[model samples]
Target: MQKIGILGGGQLGRMLLQAAANYPVETYVLENDEQAPAAHLCHHFTKGDIKDYDAVYNFGRRLDALTIEIENVNVDALEALEKEGITVIPRPAVLRTIRNKALQKNYYTTHQIPTSEYILTHNIQELSEQTHFFPAVHKIAEGGYDGRGVQIIETEKDLSKGFDTLSVLEKMVNVEKEIALMIAISQTGEIAIYPPVQMVFDKALNLLDFQLCPAELPERTYWKAEAIALATVKNFNSPGIFAVELFVTPDGDVLVNETAPRVHNSGHHTIEAHYSSQFDMVWRILLNYPLGSTEAIMPSVMLNILGSEGHSGPACYEGLNEMLKIENAFFHLYGKKQTKPGRKMGHVTVISQERADLLYKANKIKHGLSVITKADGRSG
Candidate 1:
């Protein structure tokens, strides 16, 4: 059997493990937490730090291929394993570039890829001195994910709101809408780009609340976004799935926001909406097989289930059954043991050929679902 190892056993790893069950492969996962989402699902689970050189290196030594569900692992170990003939998806160098926002932005500039203008700051003191960058977004150079490590500085007063380390100050362009393009590149160099997903963010949480597939956009805007996404994958030149988020300005300009080199939240709807899901596509890429079709079988909408406010402890889904009452609505809970305000507990996807009906069902699902918990015999 082919042996595969994955780094960081979070929800992404959990879903990948679920998909890998269809194939004859022995899977192992290395995660610091024994209770991680994928810890019990894999054939072998190593409760160790994915960032430790020895832990990651030793884990890859016994596997035919190594891939990461999270990008914060030790790249040095991956490089060593790759040199010893073990396949490392997306390559270690690419990880090194993507893990740091400054380097990622520089790569875009060097490659002539269109992106928002940004300035790198080494410390909070330096960031405070750059007043011209007001009404900007601040992102830590490394270790940022989900809605963490990012801040909006609207004025001088907001300068005290960000990290005091290496960060990027980006001019917040006037955006008409945000969209994501999920692209897959196979090991043999074959590529497929999915239909654009229009996104709407939760202003309070700074996270994607829900998204619509086959984004309702003008033909020109659609084609330009597709071209930019394809160009990004070509520039990365790595095998695996990529989620490229873009900003569409009111003037019809599409600018690169950032890119993720793994299965992303934006593509979650694909599991129920597309001919081939991102999980299946990633597996194909790892095995160097020809990619599956990227066409959407029907229009779909995905909504995130976040932990309820004022509740933190053992988790529970409050209205899942009610939410499931909607036809074609699918729910996938990330096996998280606890719930805290704003934590990603799970997601629901609704699909239908009729755009209006699809959106109507998606809205019902969102309102019906709630992730709440009881702690110390109290709701909070």
Candidate 2:
């Protein structure tokens, strides 16, 4: 059995481990927590910081192929492993591009791909002349994720809060809506893409609040999302799944926002709604196995279960049975012991053959449920 080494032991890594169990493959997960969800399932477990060079290199050297559940891990060690003839799918070079937003945007420009105009600023002096209007997005080039390290500057007074470190000043295009699509690529040139999904965010932190699969976009928008996502995958030449986030403008313009070269939170709905989930596809890609069908069996909606505000320490879900009263509601909880405000703990997906009615029911479930505290017990 060919062993695959997965970096980062969060829920994504955990699900990947479960999917690999169906095939004749062994896995070694490198993570910091012995209680991480993937730990008990894998063939071997190594508890170490994924960003440390010697730790990551030693882990990659033992596996037949290397893949990651998160992009925050050390790329330099993966590069070293590649030089030593280890098979690191999606290549370490591609990781470098995806890991940094500036390089990622540059990849689009270099390939003649259409993207919003952006200006890079290394220091306070370089950004003396600001062509951008009042409302714009300032994104940190490195180490940002899940609505963090991003700010929407609406006034000159808002600029001070964003002037800390290396950043990219971008035009805050008037976005009509937001959408995302997930695509998987294999070594034999086989490609498959999940139907584009619509994303809704919480107003507070711009955190992903919920997702609806097979977004009810006009035929053209859906096609455009697919086209953009496919182009991104081919450009990366990656051997794994990618979630391509897109922005739909008020004038019906579709622009690429960001890309992730691994299993993504946006596609979590696929577990209940699609013929094959993204975790299963990641395993197939690493094995060089024939790609799976990406068809959705039904229209689905996903609810993100974030930690309650102003609570930490041991966490619990209070209204699970109440939430499951609705038919077709499936819940999956990440085994995180501590609850921090706005932390993503788990998600639930609702699926049905009928699209429109399911949308209504999904929204009801989303509103009626609370991933918050127990009325009687301690906070979270």
Candidate 3:
């Protein structure tokens, strides 16, 4: 049996492990937490820091192929493993470029990809001097995820909120809507693109609240967005799944917002809505199998369950029974014992033939479901 290892055994890895069970493969996962979601599911689980050079290097050496659930893993070790004939999805080079906001923006500009203009700043002092570019989005060059390490600097006064580190000051675009495309590429170069997913953000937390697959976009805008996503993965030319997030302006212009070179939150609905889930697609990529169909059987909406504010420690799910009462509702809880404010704990997906009904149930689930925890240490 072939051996595969994944870095960071979080929810993404957990889902991937579940998918791998359908095939004859031995799976391993390296994570710092013993209680990580994938730990119990994988054939072999090692407790280690994914970012530690020695830990990643040692783990990659024993695998027939290696992949990542998170982007913050040590890329140098992956690069070394690639040189030794072990396959690393997304390619170490791609991760190095995608992990840094400044470098990623530059790649888009170099390829003539439509994206918001950005200025790279070395420090907060330099960022303050760029006040002329006020009302920009300040993003840390690295380690930003789930709306963290990002700030909207509306004025010079907001510069104080930025980190004193390498970052990018991106000119905020006038966005009509936000959407994402899940593109899967095979080892032999075949590609499959899922229909665009419309992202709806929570204004209060600046995090993704829910998503609608097959975003009700005009024909022209939809095709344009697809073109951008295709061009992006082609540019990297690596065999793996990529999620291209985009912004559509009121004038129908499509611009690339960012890309995640792995299974993503926007594609979660695919598990029940599409013929091939993102988890299954990744397995096909790593094993060089023919890519699966990306067709959706029905319209779907996905709601993210974030930890409620002002509650921390052990995690609890409230009103799950009520949320599950909705027709065609599917719940997936990440095996996290503890919860923190704004942390992603789980998600709910709903599907239906009627778009309106699907969206209504999505909102209902969002309101009815809550991830809360008490100060006491135990979780139910």
Candidate 4:
């Protein structure tokens, strides 16, 4: 069987490994934590930092192919592996560009991809000089993910919150709706696109709260969103699954927000709602198999299960049994042993034919489940 290794062992890696059971491949994971979410699921697990050049290089050299669960990995090592004929999905060059926010923004401009306006800042002082660019979002150039490297600079008064390193200051869009489109490209140049999904964020935490597949969009706006998303990913010219997050303005214009080059939370509902899940699509691309169908088996809503506030210890699930009793509801915990405020502990996907039914079940799951610590119980 062909051997493949994945970098990072978070929930994304865990889910990817879960999907690997049906394939004829030996899986390996490289991560520093011996008890990482994916460690036990893979055939082999190496406890090493994914960002260390030597660790990543040595781990990948023995594998036939390699992919990533996160973006902060060692790109130099991936480049070296590619040179030695080890397949690196999406190409190292793509990762290099996507890893840095400034480079990623410049790439959008250079390629004529529709995106928000922005200014690149080398430091806080440079960012201060862009006072006219107030009410913009400040995003650090590298090593930022899941709302950590991003800050809203509403005015000069909020300047202190900006990053002191290289960053991107993007003018915020007059967003009416947020949408995500999942696209997969094969090595042979074939493409498969999943239906767009509407995303709702927990504004306070800057994390996804819930999302509905086959987003509610006017015919014209849907086509526009699709065209823009297609253009954005096609410019990358690489073979891998991509999640293109986008903004729909009141004027019906669609603009690219950001892109993730792997299986993403936005597509998590695909596991139970689509004929081929995002994880399955990634395997097909790596194995050179024909792309699977992206058609949804039913309309679905997915809610993120986050740790309750004031909880920080061994994980506990409240009302899990009640959630399990709900028909057509799928619960997936990340296997994380600890609970911290705002941590993504799991997700629940509810599928139904009627939009009303989907929303009702989603709300039930959202209010019924909580990830907490037994000592703290459910905090206010």
List TM-score per model, in order: 0.97, 0.94, 0.98, 0.98
- What tens-digit string does per-residue lDDT give for candidate 1 at 1-380? 88999998988998899889977889999999998888999999998899999999999999999899888999999999999999999788889999999999998899888899999998889998888878899999999989899999998899888779999999989999899999999888899999999998999889888999988889999999999888877888788899999999999999999988998999999998999899888888887778988899989999898998897888878877777777788889998888899999888888888888877887787777788875454331
Model 3 per-residue lDDT tens digits across residues 1-380: 88999999889999999899989999999999998888999999988999998999999899999999889999999999999999999899999989998889998998989999899988999998998888899999999998899999999889888879999999889999999999999988998999999989997788998899889899999999999999988899798999999999999999998999999998999999999999999999988789998999999999888999988888988888787778689899997888889889998888899988988898888888888875565576
Measured by TM-score, how close is model 2 to the native structure? 0.94
In model 1, pairs of residues that clash are: none
Report the C-alpha lDDT of model 2 over 1-380, residue by residue, as the tens digit. Answer: 99889998888988888789889998988999998766777888999999999899999998889999888889999999989988887788888998888899899888766577787876544544563544677888899988887887776667665756677877887777789889888987789988899888887978887788778788887787788778877988767788988888877788888889999999898887898999999888999889988999888888788887876656767666677788788888887776678888888898987776667776776677555655455533
What range of 10 consecutive residues in model 3 has the weakest lDDT sum? 371-380
Q: lDDT (0-100) at residue 206 of candidate 4?
A: 92
RMSD of each: 1.6, 2.0, 1.1, 1.8
State the weakest 10-residue window (summed lDDT) of model 4: 371-380
Sort all candidates by lDDT, best to worst. Answer: 4, 3, 1, 2
**Count of residue pairs whose backbone atoms collide, per candidate:** 0, 0, 0, 0
2 or 4: which has the higher TM-score? Answer: 4
Pairs clashing in candidate 4? none
- For model 4, what is the error of residue 259's alpha carbon versus the real structure, in angstroms, after optimal superposition? 0.7
164-197 per-residue lDDT for model 4 (tens digits): 9999999988999999999999989899999999
Ranking of candidates on TM-score, top first: 3, 4, 1, 2
